[model samples]
Target: MRIAYLTIDNINDNVILAQTFPLLGRLATLPEVDGIDLFALRKHGGDRYRAYLPPTRIRVRVGNNHGIWHPLTWLHLVRFALQAWARTRAGAVLIGRNPISLLCLSLAASRRGTRLVLDYRGLLSEEYVLQGKIARRGRMHRLLRRLERWAIRRADAILCVSERLRERTVRWQPVAAGKIVVIPCCYDPRVAGRDEATIERLRGELALDPARDFVLAYAGSLSVWNRPEAIREVFHAFRQIHARTRLLLLTGDLEAAQASFGDEAAIIIRSIPHEEIQHHLALADLGLLLRDRSSVNRVASPVKFAEYLACGVPVLVTPGVGDCPDIVRREGVGYLLDADLPLSRIVSEIRANRSDFRARCREVATRYFDGDAYRALYGELVGGKAFRRLPESPSVGKACA
Candidate 1:
């Protein structure tokens, strides 16, 4: 069957490349898929996505996304819908959570008996509200929630990034629970570990003090949702215990990072290529995946969580923020650090299990980040595993369960 997959994220953005593109590649490469037409809301980087598109079987279209509340944004989605109706006779529609896309695809799917799939990473309205971009009771927020409800009910299948997120989506349509599939933002196994030589080379290039510094790195966008103050607090706390520890920020939002940490005791980096991030992560003894425990963050499956694990870097994560903490605890690969953990205990945990954590963390990452995990889950969601035959490993199911 031909599938028309759409993401609300910018196609060429580092975020999409990390999570969405790998899955898109998996789907497009399948023999049963005659072709897959991918639609995106924006294009941040030039020519990054072009090399990945298989010219014959996969086609892509991206639209304007200048402002979130802009009327033109809605018009752009409508235009994408129109384009989809005109250019593709798809049997299945897979969409990332964008209300306008949902509204348009509902109409498009109804006419063609197209299977509708919702990739509900997090509730869009809740994300905005938690980030202080919108009021929970405001007209736009309520309207988007209404649209989200409609989309949830209309979708033939649903994919949630976390199990908690799936439970949250059930509040919208309890009957649709049967169709929901848990597929977290996964990591690419190819870049799982970096050689010490390469890591040391990069350390020199980036002017990092390889011998003295214990890099505590955070990679991904520095959004309004992130607690930069909290990051600093934790870094300082960790540093007080382990004097060699240094905060490393690898982010696209340099301005925001600077504003929060202006020439402070941290190493700031511009957004590097997604493929190169794993190598940089290898330099970090601990990776940071700290976020506020709001409704949105509680359900988020941060891609960086898996990326860190893939690079054999243990994480210092906040509690009750989706599956990461549980995975960390179960695997003994990371620390679920409280804001007030004592310095002595913190230092002991780090110094004692450093080697064991590195080995086990990579093992746990292999189980969670395998692309086939999502491929199998998607196949189950769409009612068949016949579409793609990637080898199924039992370890992932065990790890996630």
Candidate 2:
């Protein structure tokens, strides 16, 4: 079957490269897939990500960026939907990687017999309300919620990032239960690991004291959803007990990081390129996946959680951030930290079993987060029959259970 995927995210966004592109690449390689047409909107740095696209069996189109929430954006998506419909044979799969894409693409998809897939990430309208972007009872919020429901109802399949999210989706729209497939935000195992040389190099470059300093790393944006203030509070509390510890913030928004943490001169905050993130992550002894206990985070799976584990770094994650706390406890890979909890005990535990944690974290990451592990799952979602035969890198990782 031919497939056409549309994402409203900037083609250059880390989400596109880390999650969407990998899924697309996996789909393109499936024997059941004839070819894939990927539709995206270009902004600055879009060409850089374009270079990473699969060179065979996939064609890409990065259209002009008219800006999000603008009227032109909807028109652009409508055009993308119509284009995908016109180009593909009947019964081709049309996937919308976000709510906006799904809503617009569904319009064109309904007119055709193509299957529609919703790449449901989280509670979109609720997220906006939490971020203060929209009032909870406002017309825009209600409209967005309605459109989200409509899109969900129209989807032939729905890809959820967490089991909790799938549950929530089902509760919100009972019809979604049968169509939903839980696929967590995964990481590429190839570049994610602990390399001795990389650790040494980054240690020297960042002036990190290997003998004295215990490193705690946080990677991602300082966006409202990330709760940058909560990150700071956690790091500060950890730092109070472990005076020699360093908090490393590897973020894309350097300016925002500076604004949030610049006053602390001892903090190491850098905006490293996406390709170099794993190397920087290798320098850390512990990764921080702090999040508020909100509805949005409860059903969300942050990619950073997988990334930290993939780099052989155990996390100090918040208790209710998606399925992370359960995984951490089940695998003995990390600690579940609460805001009110004291850090001395957690610190001692980590110090005592750092090596064991590192090894176990890598093992858990291979089992859960590796993209290779999810190939068969992706095949199931896309209705591709070659999943069992899909190429596996025996040296790299194992298939998902």
Candidate 3:
């Protein structure tokens, strides 16, 4: 049997590291996975994450540069169909994401003995609408919903990024309840475990006076949905309590983000490699994740949430941030942001339970968002529990040979 992962995301995209790459790696780790192929409509050639991969197969369609409006977009779909049709055979499972990929891949995966598995990584239409990219009931909006319904009906198994997302998906397609599984934005435990020396060096490089200041870190896209003004508000709140508070902004477009907070004692970092995120995160006393409580947010799972925890840094997030709210309160590893006064409570509590929260946050990361969880979930998807607890091990799950 062969398993294929199809996506429209560029192969080198930072998100692909945490999403597509880790998934394919987990499947490749499985002994039962005979052949694993990753099919991406890539931005460029060669895989940047090849070193991190667990020897998975790769097949990509390059030169895709446009969105739905472009004529080349449809051509990309036609090319994918031809390529997928050529490789069509018995006992194949195509795990797909993105509306274009899932909609088009479903057509080719219709061949006998091929399975279609939809991984709804995000609530696409809802998100786009919230971002003001589409009208509430526009032509594009309806088309996206139609595609989502089409995939839900055809998917043999469905993977959701969060439990709330899975529930919402079930609400839309009631009959899909049985086939759904929640697979969150996962983190590699290894990335968060930097030695003391590495952390110290990173601190020096960033000129972080961690001994005095409370370093707060926020990485990834600085999207409008993040409520950029609220992020500034949180920082000012922290600065009020702690005089030496500094915010670390790690994003691809640091210039735009830095302009929002001019001349503050902030370190604006752009294009930092995915692996190096841990080093910067290590210097922080707390991680910050605050987004609008839009309907699209209810099903959202932010990779930063898991990565922060894995690095043993507590997160300060607003309520309704996917599973973080539940985990933060339940585990006492983080706090919920109060818009009226965002950082006061977390800052005070953090002073007393700094050591305790560190351990608990890492624990939560392993229990919930660890990459190992996905390994088991994928294992279960393929057959009888491909991921299992080893008799001799204390960890939650281990890859089966």
Candidate 4:
């Protein structure tokens, strides 16, 4: 069977999608599955255009440029729906984060008797409110919430990145409880398994003195939800405990973050290519994920946590948000800080348990965050069975062979 995957974001730049691509590549090895076609609607000037095939080898089609605003985006949605409806004979329509695209894809797939799986990566409306871009009780927020509810209700299945998000979505759309599935963002073992030499080389290149200074690293978007202030707190605590401890931040918003905290840290590397992330991870002694306690963050499942574990780097995370604390606790991989805990206490704990912490990190990645398990989960979701027997080959068409 053929499936049409839809997205509105810059699919090329999204790390979650890139990580999942290998799983999709593996799924293509299934004997019973035909193929997975990606349909993306992108912006171009004031008008939208379509491309039948993507520029790269990735299985995707780019539709004509759609205007970024309301009515034009809706028109592009209708056009994309028509195209997807006409192209795929029977299977599933996998909808990504776009609410407008989900609505149109739902309608198209319903007409063509195709199943719909909605990938609600995050609560967009709630995210907007948490970012202070929109007021939670305002007219626009209420309207978007209504649309989100409608889309959730319409989906045949809902794929959430975290259990917390699944719970929240079910609470909002109680009817979707049985339909919801949790598939957290995971680290691809291929990316996670860099050689020791490569890692050491990266350490040298970054000028990271592992013997002299303890490294604290944070990688990903430098957004408000990530709580830059928490980094400051951690650094302050580190200074009190160990004068040589250094903080390193690698993020997309380098200019803004630099403006905020560049002068404070001993070393701050701005955003690097996603490919270079593992190198930084390898150089780090500790990983930090300290999010603000916003409603959006409460359901966040950050990919960085898994990456840290995969690289055998211990993490220091905040509790009461998403599954990070639970996973860390269950796997014995890292420490979880209560928001009310004094920064000094946190620093003391880290300093006291450094050796055990690193060991826990290795154990957790080996046990729970195994890439084989992640591949099997994706296979089950898409092919209705595990992919344990699948071979590692680059044949894109063999996924559903």
* TM-score to true structure, per model: 0.89, 0.91, 0.90, 0.82
lDDT of 2 by residue, 48-107 (tens): 886666556878877767766677776777788788767866668889877878865765
Q: Give every collision pair in model 2.
A: none
Candidate 2 regions with alpha-carbon error over 4 angstroms: 111-113, 384-401
lDDT agreement with native, every candidate: 0.72, 0.78, 0.73, 0.66
Model 3 stretches with alpha carbons more than 4 Å out: 44-53, 266-270, 339-342, 384-401
lDDT of 4: 0.66
* lDDT (10s digit) by residue, model 4, range 1-401: 66667776544443534454544555555555577777665543222222212233346666554444467766666777787777756555455454656776765566555667676777777877876768888987898788888888887666677768877887777897766656666665554666778778877766777656778898877776788778878877777777777787888777878777868648666677666677677677779998877778788777788778777678889876687888777666667876565656655565577667766776666555454554555555554332232333211101221
> lDDT value for candidate 1?
0.72
Model 3: which ten-residue window has the lowest total lDDT?
392-401
Off by over 4 Å in 4: 41-58, 63-75, 339-356, 383-401
Q: Give the TM-score of candidate 2.
A: 0.91
Residues 82-146 of candidate 1: C-alpha lDDT, one tens digit per residue: 77666545456556455556666665675565677777788788877876778989998898888
Report residue 314 deviation for candidate 3 (angstroms). 0.5
Superposed model 1: Cα runs more than 4 Å off: 52-56, 88-90, 131-133, 205-212, 265-270, 383-401
Better of 3 and 4 by TM-score: 3
lDDT digits (tens) for residues 44-91 of candidate 3: 545565665655655445547476556886687677777777777777
Strongest candidate by lDDT: 2
